[model samples]
Target chain A: MEKDHKPSSTEKPVLQKVAKLFLYTFLIVIAVVQVLPLVWLFLFSLKNNQEVFNLPPLALPQDPQWGNYARVWTEGNIGQYFFNSVYITASAVILTVIFASFVTFAITRMKWKLSSLVLGMFMVGLMIPVHSTLIPLFNFFLNVNLMDHPLAIILTYTAFNMPITIMILLGFYYTLPRDIEEAAIMDGCSVHRLFFQITLPMTAPVVATTAIINMIYNWNEYVFVNTFISSDKFKTLTVGIQNFIGQYQTDWGAIGATLMISILPILIAFFILSNRIVEGITAGSIKG
Target chain B: MNKVMSDKKVIALYVLPAFLLLMLLVYIPIVLTGYYGLMKWDGIGSMEFIGLENYRNLIVDSAFWRSARHSLLLAIFSVISLIGYLLVSLVLSGRIKGADLFRKVYLIPMLLSSVAIAQLWMRIYHPTNGVMNRLLTSIGIEQPPLWLADTNIVLYSIFIPIIWQYAGFYILIYYAALRNVPNELVESARIDGASPWQIGYKIKLPLIAGVIKVTIVLAVVGSLKYFDLIWVMTQGGPNGASEVIASYMYKQAFTTYNFGYGSAVGFFLLILCLIITYIIRKLTATKEEVQY
Candidate 1:
């Protein structure tokens, strides 16, 4: 029935208010659920073993012990691991942009014969799940003495992160208008300089998206961190935190404490780039 | 011929570095993972060839089938809830003021590490004095099941956080697609006396079927490879109640160090992913590209 559609006046206001009430209440509940684990994480972080497992779980600390963070930092070497993650993640992001931007230029501007072929090959990597590749990559790393080396994961992360990065930059660079590019070409800018100056600046938003997304992946990564990196110094937060879960016995309080500390970057990133991050993920997936 | 040759080389020059890197990390390993299926290697010693034995045994391995079933179940539940919730969220996004805030709350979990999210869910599902059970009892329920610990509910329990975490991504997808629909169509519907719900179901949904189709496909693919959450929450445990294919394969390769068996499962995963994605690609894609 293509009966022409319209909003009925009588029910509209009532429905709108009811919807508003439901939505506000729902948001309040979601906000609580969203933040509650964090609250539990912080609360447990301060409690001793007795209080952690206490019935009616300790809502707040009777005694606020500041030592758990220290233990996780010193004994856990979370500080060292944090630095290692930052170092590796920084290198990986830089490498990803360098390689991906070059490829994007070749495909979009250089009129390379293998442009489509190159993209097709990288696209294949996206379909093959990580489980299939882990063992061989592990052996390759082992044979090369990259076992527990941050560089090993950095190399692989650059490769694994490429598929999505190329997907993004390819789309972004392709969509760029041609007259400005021709004008730049007339100005004696080389292909490389064109990318860095005119073309690159134009794609700044996408570059930000790619870099932030890659940083997040490298920060929270577990399987690669656990597999290739064995030593304490090399262990990132996810792997380092797992140490608290085992060997002698699990320490719930310390585990919670470490978890609270671990999510700080994500929280800060969310606070700053919440809209951009959501938009990036959706745009990359839906369009690219 | 020279012109064509130079053109090809230029393309090669551009894509070669990225392409070669992928070959090392992705292609060779996948080939090896498949190749190892025929050889019984313990990952430390000489690889002895026993072609198809892993697959033969896998056929009889009840645990493998059980894990596959769980993966399939998780896939179904996640796809249904994720798509359903995202659509509802999209609709609410239309009507609700302060939608940006709701979306932010939803997306916080997605930004954090999967391990962090898992640990969060573990607390949510805690047996005694967990937030979930506490909420239940406060609302007049006497019984509270140990969520991650209980075998039956464990798989579904694992899905809750995943669905919650990922719903935001899908909402963004639908929202973007909704935005692209010409305002005239929506305004016209309003002028023609259709209810908001009617306008959505009739005009909006079918219009964005392509995006919805994609959301479905991604949901399926993402769920199949789902491991991080399952590994963190329950290492396919409490009697292997929540074993996805990836986690089960992980236990073999890393935990038990059975490289050959793990490789065989990895091949199976490859084939499964191919079949699923191929079917989806075929279904969603039209012969002629739809240009807006």
Candidate 2:
């Protein structure tokens, strides 16, 4: 197989060009299809039912009624829901990162049989679908009287997400050289000081990356939130949009309106920190 | 003594706190699911011993079969769709400036909440005012089929968004794999008069088989646990045409109040996962571990 640079006798220039053109065309068409829904979502959010259904449905809203958006936020309690979403998602990311980082630190730096055993338990969680064990989890929470509470959903989300967090972080942790850690000991550094000073600073990119990934997951997570948070008081934006559908069936105008509102916070967060999110996730996955 | 805790055993204590939490939350739930699967509790009532009844019911349950069938279909379709998207993405990964731009646009959907995506696509697929139908009508095609309403088409319609949300993931994975292929192999193929397809199949693809294996395993798991988008889109609707095992479990637990049966569904799902994992490990274990 290892030969000199000799052109394949069978290859043709026309066929090569044909293949490249075909692939490029295919990719472009799919890219358009991917973007089309978001475009339509934007359009429908603005138009009333009549215009929405009008022939050759307008690509751009005729009048551009911004009031639907205002109504979506106000009537649906989306503001409160969004606030609740951010609070839960942010806190979950923080707590999970802390718990995951500590485990990664100990597992990677400290050699013990339990490191792998603990990691194995976390991996078991990875394979267990939430539905299978949801009731037991529900009963456990109910026994602790945590139903209809944000704390309940947050804790559940944190527990479910920990496996992935640790898995991804372990990849990063294993890549680091242990020399600095060993050096820290010669200088009388304690575990706490060594982590904060030597390890933590170097782990910046991954921590940022995990934060973005975990935040996206927690923010958009629905199943646990929907099941645990039956009350109007504890709903997040995704659940809120869902409940909006239940209450206002076939009300496409309001439905479209609420859906648009639901994505704004994510859009804001992603756009503001776009650089961080993209780099972080790619780094984690590529390294994995 | 206030000295260094360098004993290797100290690592166990450090990992204990996190290990206990994972046990309480994760391993415990799994064990409880297996235990509850054997009972006749309606989630709230006292547990009654009903050994093998739930499993027996599972065998003859049409709904369970439907859901299991849906899981199989999802796994098959998702893997196939991923392959198609990847083939297209691989061709466009490099040799084009727009690949990164397309990559970004394709990935925008990933950041979106599934419910939001469901709502967005639901409007796009709405019977009368849908963009899909309107585009069809503009080109003089009359009454394009209802995407979500038609039972036969509804499952595929739901898959459209799923493919869009996930294709970017595979694209990135394959692109990374593509980058690892030595340019000399590709250049040498070209110089030897090999077409892109020939070069891709003979060289690039064989080299990247490991990544594809991981991707397929992921696709399998994703298909099984798929809930959010389809639930939001169709809710296994039009007379349960789109239900997966996970959703069926949800329906039993939440809608029908059959907690024990729901737990049994979970046990089945766990077993399914284990079987798949075992198969994948066995398949890969005999081969060399290709680093790239």
Candidate 3:
């Protein structure tokens, strides 16, 4: 009996090792699948049309053409579009965070008769498809002479992002102990002062999280900018790249370079703030 | 403290700016979208009130139905893919080495804008010089299919990237949820001689049922409203074979200048989303949420 048990135990250990090996391979394969396309994109970006067609798909660029990046930046409106995206994304994220914080503070901290009702309105705003609002917004922007303006894009980003930003902030706000705010108030601090100094400071971690999320959304937003701002000067990278690619449609390296530049900022931000971005995405979605 | 917190003046100052923006932009436009559906107006022209004519045409529009069907197919595909994501999450959440690195690597694609993703994929699907065909030929399959140009498979081809973009997001959510399941419960089940599969399927999944439900709703509604990728990659193209609801609405309003018809379609999409959300919630509502 002891000899039989020993063989079985040894076999079990071997089988478990095999299973573990299989699991790791499975995971690594998925990781490879996810990153390979981007890898190929980066490789192709550094190669000219000849190298791109001649070389293997994953082959390293024999002579990396860094000029592709320079040409796209100088020859196209990519610089202007990049600047527009940066400012638009920054402005919208700032506005969304501030407004969301105020509303969140008011609902979670302040006593209000219609607090729940008001909160419900913003929450339901999440379910309203942006498509439903697109035409009216276009008309509204046209009527108000803001059709081709950057302000139109900024305001729309702020409003559309408000619900999700507030949602992420709400979770953090609810968990915050009101002790310090109450004590500050007991010392005769005003509501505005309490919010600005006490509550807002305490919620900075979540504010950072939501800000990154909003930056991603606003940076990547396509349709509203595509519709409202048709001019090259005001177009964000998403739309700008669309038109830029149209001109350089046959120049694989140039188109690849342009696409890389557009996505690089977000990718850089992701590498730096991945933890916060992950936390933000989980927080924003899991509550649904 | 109560008086300071409840100050009507301060509260109004704090809330009114955001609240008014929400109303002006989101809520008001929704009402206007429905109202605009009752009119005959080419965006820049004077409106002629034509009650329900657009809606009537929408009912008989084969193109709209086809797009709606494509949207539904996408929704189904997204829901089915959730199972694969969940399986991957279950594996990742297990005591695996380098799980964090694996998870983040998977998330890289999700960070990209749809336009960039669409452009990158168009090159991937390029008929003559694409990575896809290159790999196919190297593997000795000479006749690789034209991915986006083929009307028969365009929708399915588009669905692959949609799945790729969202896989990490769903996995991240599930991993977080599965991590939240109490270790003691899992350990106890293991001590009771449960197999690993049983431990995952029987114990972990049931506990994260609520998260699973939310993901289903997200995947479905998100698929129904999926636009940017399809718009960029195919533009509902190969003869409209890949059109989804949002892309179709976009085409009607922005491209074709059929403002009235687009609004009607847009209104229908809004109602469909809300109703589907409500129904999924109702169907998946647990009698009592499992408490640890």
- Against the reference, the lDDT scores of all candidates come to 0.78, 0.79, 0.92
Query: What does DockQ come to for candidate 2?
Result: 0.55
TM-score of each: 0.91, 0.92, 0.98
Candidate 2 per-residue lDDT over residues B128-157, each given as its tens digit: 667787788789999799898898988888
All candidates in order of TM-score, best leading: 3, 2, 1
DockQ of 3: 0.80
Query: Distance (Å) between predicted and true CA of A89, model 1?
Result: 1.5
**In model 3, where do residues sit more than 4 Å from their true spots?**
A1-8, B290-292
Better of 1 and 3 by DockQ: 3
Residue pairs with clashing backbones, model 2: A7-B191, A7-B192, A7-B193, A8-B192, A8-B193
Model 2 chain A weakest lDDT span, ten residues long: A1-10
lDDT of 1 by residue, A172-225 (tens): 787888778777777765565666787778888888888888888888888888
Instruction: Report the number of clashing residue pairs per model.
Output: 8, 5, 0
Candidate 1: CAPRI quality band: medium
Which model scores highest in DockQ?
3
**Candidate 1 deviant stretches above 4 angstroms:** A1-12, A46-67, A247-252, B1-13, B134-143, B286-292
